[model samples]
Target chain A: MFAGLSAFPLTPLRNDEVDEVAYAGLIERLVAAGVDSITALGSTGAYPYLTTDERRRVARVALEHAGSVPVVVGVGALRTSQVIGLARDAADAGASGVLLAPMSYQPLTDDDVFGLYEDVAAAVPLPVIVYDNPGTTHFEFSDALYARIAQLPNIASIKIPGVPAEPDAARARVEQIRSAVSDRVTIGISGDASAARGLNAGCDTWYSVIGGTLPEAALAICRAARSGDAAAAMAESDRLQPLWDLFAEHGGSFRVIAAIAELGGLVTPNSLPLPVRGLDRTARDRVARVVRELGLIPPA
Target chain B: MFAGLSAFPLTPLRNDEVDEVAYAGLIERLVAAGVDSITALGSTGAYPYLTTDERRRVARVALEHAGSVPVVVGVGALRTSQVIGLARDAADAGASGVLLAPMSYQPLTDDDVFGLYEDVAAAVPLPVIVYDNPGTTHFEFSDALYARIAQLPNIASIKIPGVPAEPDAARARVEQIRSAVSDRVTIGISGDASAARGLNAGCDTWYSVIGGTLPEAALAICRAARSGDAAAAMAESDRLQPLWDLFAEHGGSFRVIAAIAELGGLVTPNSLPLPVRGLDRTARDRVARVVRELGLIPPA
Candidate 1:
């Protein structure tokens, strides 16, 4: 369950509230796509933008619609107690695991981050996926820290950012992590742009962003790579180069994926929580054009 | 209202909830100390760790006990709509101004940040303080963005991180920001250790951490600087050099200040919100010893 492709579906918001209907539909799409796992409230789900009650509901909503697939809920918060509460909520809501990121405001020390994982892990029985997305949380996880955390109770996976693009370097990075972590802990790759490279390089799973909204395209790359068809995986990834470029051209995957979800009718217009202005019309038009050109939009 | 010594009080928590009584007492202490301004919910206040209702109550408590002193409320959040709501709460709670930090979870674009200030400024009637503490928020504000956001209505100040240590360099840095921002926007210096240098360098305010708990020590620095006694200002700051070193040794001011507050019998012990482990016993002993040596603990 920890290996293979984990599709992170957008928890689309409407009227500044979780649009349950739209969110349920997005989850249903993922279930139908046969994603190995459904990770709700990952960065793509705008977890930090949500309130505790809202996050609980979103977790419950995801589990309800996730069918038989394992569901991992992102329960990262700035406070350890809050994360513990969310982790409990995820467990209560029947999530298969919880994703824990040391989300920071006042930059944390090494002990601070380690203690967060230790406390949360000790508090919850559900499996914990150590989230290492520094781009958003701005908290870098040292290798020693990773090694230390992987020994904690209920730790199931380590979701690292994109690997070094060089294939050998990526492999070295993966091996280094694999050697550090408990053998039971799977290594998952985030950063959708580098999913193929990461998977091809030895990562056991792709904890994806684009896969959240456009599962078919991501599945093409994942299936190819998982089947040992590295060239075919690269080729599949290359086919969607335009969409990847959109992610870079805009900023990160968050807004571009949001635009994709909105333009592809997976979400309502302006679906992103505020402060995050979804791409402007011109940018959205560009995203829509590329998404259409790539045939990412589902046929009605 | 945005200028002079803006003491940032700790909204100390007990048992995972805002310790409102302890909080109100902290505010009263600041009021009695006659701080130039009381900034509730600043980084030292652990605003990001708090819930909206907790934040609202903290703001109201500060205002209620602040006597005639101006109370600047930190209303920063990850979401724009949430900030808008908090800014409204600040206004309704009778805040003198709102301190707006571009708090990030998903790394934000310059446009996204500017739009946040634009939206919040439009939605609130109170003055706004542009809080540029990259140490906590991890969102760097460029001079161009500062110049841009400072132009928005109700922008009363820009609270920047510590300036360059060198007097000439600090002055130049201050001058550069002064040149960029609107004449109405005062340039306040955070980073308590650099308050004297920044204030002597022509920055308008000291948005201080220690000031919230040990107001007299900060007042000495603030008063000497404001009175143009540059040598005296530096000397007074030098007096607390021991405390400042603790801040550096501890990685940041948040935990150190919480330690000070707890040792001085201001807040209950273990006062900070969770995930943020307050200073360990050894560190707290060091903090307590420094507080005693510096004469920061007020007479019983």
Candidate 2:
């Protein structure tokens, strides 16, 4: 359950509330597509934007709908006490494991981050995934910090950001972190664009953003690598270059993924939380055209 | 009311709850010291660490105890709806203005950030202070973004981070921003170590961190600068170089300020939000030695 493709789904919203039905639909889609794991309340899920009650409900929905696929809930907060509380909630809701990001407002010291993982480890019995998404959390992890934290009990995995573009560089980077943590801790690659490259570099899992929405496409790439066909995996990823380009041009995957969900009718229009407007008409139209051209959406 | 020294007091906590009596005492002390205004939920106030209800209670306590001092509330949240809601609460509590930072979970685009201020401006009636605290919020506003936001109606002030150390460069930085906004928008400076320099460089206000706990020392530097005594202001700031050194050595002012508040009997021991630990015993003893030598604390 700790390895292979882990899909990160958006917890869609409607009228300023979590659209539980829509969110469960997202999870069921991932489960049906056969992702090895489903991570609810990921950065894609807008965990920080939600209230405690909303998070609890979202966790329960994911657990109920995910069926055999292991559910990993993101339990991150600014305060240590809050993170611990969220971790307990996740455990109570039957989460298989908890993904913990050292979410920060005060720029956290390495010690502060270590203290966070330490406290969570002491309090929660579930496996902990050390979430290292600096793009959102703004706290970069040192290999030393990863090494230190990976030694803690139940530190199940480390979700690293994108690998370097070049093949050798990506492998070396993965190996560097690999040398730091023990073999029991799986290495999962995020940064949807670099998924193929990271997998070929021997990463055990793709903690994928795109996997949540287009699981069939994501699994095509994931399965190719697992079958030892590295070239096929890269070829599959290249096929989705348009989507990766959109992610780069925009700030991140959240809005772009939301745009796709709306176009596919998987989620309602205006499904994003307030203050995050959808892509402007021109960019959105470009996405529709590209998805159709790529056969990701049926042409009219 | 947006100019001069605006003290940012910590909303002291005890046993994981807001210590309202202690919080009121901190506000009253700032009032007695005659700061130009009181910002109840600045980064110093641990605004992001608190809940909406805790923030509301703190705002009311600040208003009730501040007498006639203008109170500006920090209404920052990760989601746009949450920020606007906090702003509405601030307005309902009679805050003179609201300070807003682009609090982020997913890295925000410039457009995303602009839309946030736009939504808040349209939704809330209070004067808006554009809080540019990158150390905490992790979002940097380009000068163009600042100019763009300043054009919004009800945008009252811009709280810039700090000026360059060189006098000429500092003045140029201030002048660069001044040329963009109309005079109706005041320019406030944060970064406590640089406040005197910023004031000397003609910044209209000092949005201070240290001022929340040590008003007299901050006011000395601020008053000297306002009285056309730039040299004295520099000297006053220089006299507190030891404290500045401590701030420089530590991560930021939050822990050090918590230590000061605790040592001076303003709040209970370990009043900071959890996961954020106080300084080590050695560092704390050093702080105590410096304070006693500087007469910040009476001998004991």
Q: Highest lDDT, which number?
A: 2
Lowest-sum lDDT 10-residue window in model 1 chain A: A291-300
* Two-chain DockQ for each candidate model: 0.71, 0.67
Q: Which stretches of candidate 1 lie over 4 Å from their true place?
A: B298-300
Q: What is the C-alpha RMSD of each candidate to the true structure, in Å?
A: 1.9, 2.0
lDDT of each structure? Answer: 0.89, 0.91
Residue-wise lDDT of candidate 2 within A110-180, one digit each (tens)?
A: 88899899989999999999999898888899999999999999899999998899999999999999999
Taking chain A of model 1 alone, its TM-score versus the true chain A equals 0.98
Residue pairs whose backbone atoms clash in candidate 2: none
lDDT of 1 by residue, A225-244 (tens): 99999999999888888888
Model 1 clashing residue pairs (backbone): none
